[model samples]
Target: MTGNQASAGHLLRLIRTGEATTRGELQEATGLSRSTVGHRLDQLFRAEWLRDRAGISTGGRPSTRLEFDAAHAVVLAAALETRHARLAVFDLAGTVLAERTEPLLLEDGPDKVLVRLAEWFGPLLAEAGTAPGKVCGIGLSVPGPVDWEAGQVVQPPIMPGWDRYPVRRRMREAYAEHVGPVSSDPLPVLLDNDANLMAYAEQRAGFRDCGAFLLVKVSTGIGAGVVVGGEIYRGIDGGAGDIGHIRLPDRTDALCKCGSFGCLAAVASGRALAGQLSALGIPAASGSGVREHLAAGRPEAVRLAREAGRRVGEVLATVVTLLNPGVLMIAGDLAGAPFLTGVRELLYQRAMPRTTANLQVVTSSLGERAGLTGAAAMVVEHLYAPDRADARLAALESVSREPHLSPGPR
Candidate 1:
């Protein structure tokens, strides 16, 4: 490989991913000379991004195994729902240092919610004993489709004022306002759909070997996330898995938030069931409220949720036929046994036998924290990948060369 291509960051990525743990293995994998490999390893070691551990003896001398030091950096993550938000400070390895969930209505608009998130970050960082400079990047999970390239939400149904919002810039400004100016640079902010992040996290943690993974989130709105070959399949312009807007033939009168009639979400979403319950003298309003009712074993809520699940399952029948996912996961507030059973009743019955032969229908194992976990993982992976990692390393090295300035705060 060329010198510009085989950088210290590239070598570190190899070690971080377990692709090559020893110098000899790195040399073999990269086709670099031993001296070139040694130079790269030294740079990584000096940056504290890599450490060495004793390795098993093979022949002449035992090789030292290189390992990624996850504690070298931290990530800030937030998952914003329609009615509430969850925020956390995580290490590079996706371990939560400090986290909290609080009520913050999305309809309040981007400025207010983002400022609140910034306010929360201060205490969270202090509580975790993480300094501002230690934060490598930030990740935000929202309940809408994201223009990943633009770092903005695009035409969200529930989030009225957030269409094409400058989420990343506002978040960076709020963060600076709350935490004071960062030394090295403003932290990179990344955004994605909540269901997409949840599905990505679940598949990586449990079903990494599965070539195709699908997850349906049955919350205030219904959305699906699909992962194929370990990568999220965001269709052209990030609108691939918007199964909630799929129209149902029989529910012609149901009106969705997106101004469409007969949309699946209008009939089968948590919001729909809550409205049905409210009409029947119940006080349900949000998806969380529906979850509470379900937990209490309310007969009407249970029945309605199951019916919703069946509707979702009917739609998923086509998805299964098209994607042929090996693992179909049910997540969000309505991911309980009754709902899953109803889904199975429709999905297995309607889908082709060949599709269902090896499909495994399951519930979310990460529960409510899946989005947060996935957000952190996304940030870590993005910031530390080979190409990006080299730039970051160069920035760090340049800062180090200036003897007057130490490596930013943490």
Candidate 2:
């Protein structure tokens, strides 16, 4: 119906977002002719990226409603906590198909942990029944500040020997080695801070309407993730939410992992609580251990966790006044009822009335899976968005064009 061609990615995006679900609607949205829409739709159909079903009629025959085929590609997601890691294989729509929990320590450094992740990919892919070539991308969540563009961590206090490491490149190579060679070429990898990813997933899943959101993770270390206007607010160099290192007036002698004294994390983080608990004859060694102690209703652990929450809440009081986030989420190992109660006590008491008026202090709904889900969603959005989707489509088409070449699982 028109001389110029419409982009397949544009048409696919329209359908994927439910903006234009029918051929007529797509033609109208893009100002393309029906035939142009048909041609573009054909590309997506051939790639198994979209499917169509009958839609309700307005006045005439029912139109076909196009929908994104989530099964078209899969994403591998990993969340590297301080003491353990969680890995999952997810479809394009963020549905986890396969998952595993492993006690991989981040203190082992990036090389060993990332290599272990590579080793796990083969079995994970097999379990998910996803071919190596079908993997669109991989997403990793690490407990550190990430230079997102460089795909590397920067001066992470807890992640030893990982500063400025080439995580994406090394992880890609490891994947290729473990899963096969094909995974090396087209499979993109992305990395971000764990709290950032967790906040991203939680906000998208539960508070999509909230323009400003905040998530504080109180595990072995402490960190905050901020989302403003539906996007992560990574500062100029990804150091925006390092609230854990905020110097506290009362804790001037407390030593922090960043070799700083008086940081809030040094006084009130889960690691701090664990140390205090151990001194009290409890066996708490890490954040997870503190969680276990709290689960068993250990009085010392609960008391320390509540105190930690109060300290974090004091900082959040200032944060609430400044950012006025609609949702202030408390997450990580120390996000239980006692901690939440303590946070509420200080936050509500210290923050201005106007700030607390609209604020909703909530706990994590996604639990340990938040980071993985966020990682998956991050990969899906990055790879399938309008600006990037066309190039990906072109690459896919090029591979398809080469009939003799077999795609390997890199």
Candidate 3:
């Protein structure tokens, strides 16, 4: 890559990530010469793509920190849940614009959903006044196993018949049809497990200081996102940190969608809770209903949530023993309220005190937006590759007359 490419890539990452970095810091981070960093900053400032604010004085000299101009560019992020889909427009500064959620009619499957998504983009971008060309790319979070390398959803147990779905291909094609495409620069698409995205959001956005952590989703199904050294660990085949299919020692009767009988998801997932509640004559068509019942102090709902939490915690205790993460961040519909409380109680009680001593389990701060935000983060990270960043920077400069803005991701 050219020096221009190196500068553009480094600057994009600095902006996209919302890092409050100074030129000296950027030079150190990018391993570039002071002159190179200064030259790029000048070019970006001349293009109105970057803005700097005076930062706190250091012991030697006060520094000015750089930030991306939100008005200069935007990213659109989407995530597919079992019951609905979420969409958000995010400025380069990580501000969310026009967040919208719509019900998922799974009966119609991928085609209908993809079309609806494509339709929504035009109106949404118009509302945000963001030109289609200004959008770096879109990131997606799917509710199943994903071949991140191939950008495909592969053999999703919960999303039946969606096996080997070319989600990235269809989405990029549909979006390009509506928005027009670059001759040789097709819009990039990235895919990751939805729960893993949530974990990424939690660890990077809300809990960045926590060097290692586990973010667990106890929603329609159970899944986990594991972060070590501040990076997501996708194992071989991109299935790392997927704890849903781990067998539970006590399960015997429940059958899983994967044709298993004893998985943690089979025993303690939101679907499992709904079934357990339904068997007890409670109304729980949705996990939200179960949460409402718990909030209303319904004893039965409380009892069931607590029991499920305990079961989940028991399964997690083994993982805790193995991973020894610094903290456990729980998300999803049932992860808070009565569910996570019970989990914390049970995990501490069951796991070795030494293991529990340093571990602090908490609810996710990003909540429902975590998945979408992480999707945006994914695109920002991938697009900032040194090979592509210079072209993207040039595109941004040519697309808008504004000064080059610092690109940062939230």
State the C-alpha lDDT per candidate: 0.90, 0.87, 0.77
- Report the number of the highest-lDDT candidate: 1
The TM-score between candidate 1 and the true structure equals 0.96
Model 2: lDDT of residue 406? 52
Candidate 1's C-alpha runs over 4 A off are 1-5, 57-61
Clashes of each: 0, 5, 19
Candidate 1: pairs in clash: none
For every model shown, what is its TM-score relative to the native structure?
A: 0.96, 0.95, 0.85
Q: Predictions ranked by lDDT, top down?
A: 1, 2, 3
RMSD of each: 1.7, 2.4, 4.7
Model 2 residue runs over 4 Å out of place are 1-6, 57-60, 183-186, 399-410
lDDT tens digits, residues 112-180, model 3? 777788778878888877677777678888878888888877777788667777777788788887765
The positional error of residue 114 in candidate 3, measured at the CA in angstroms, is 1.4
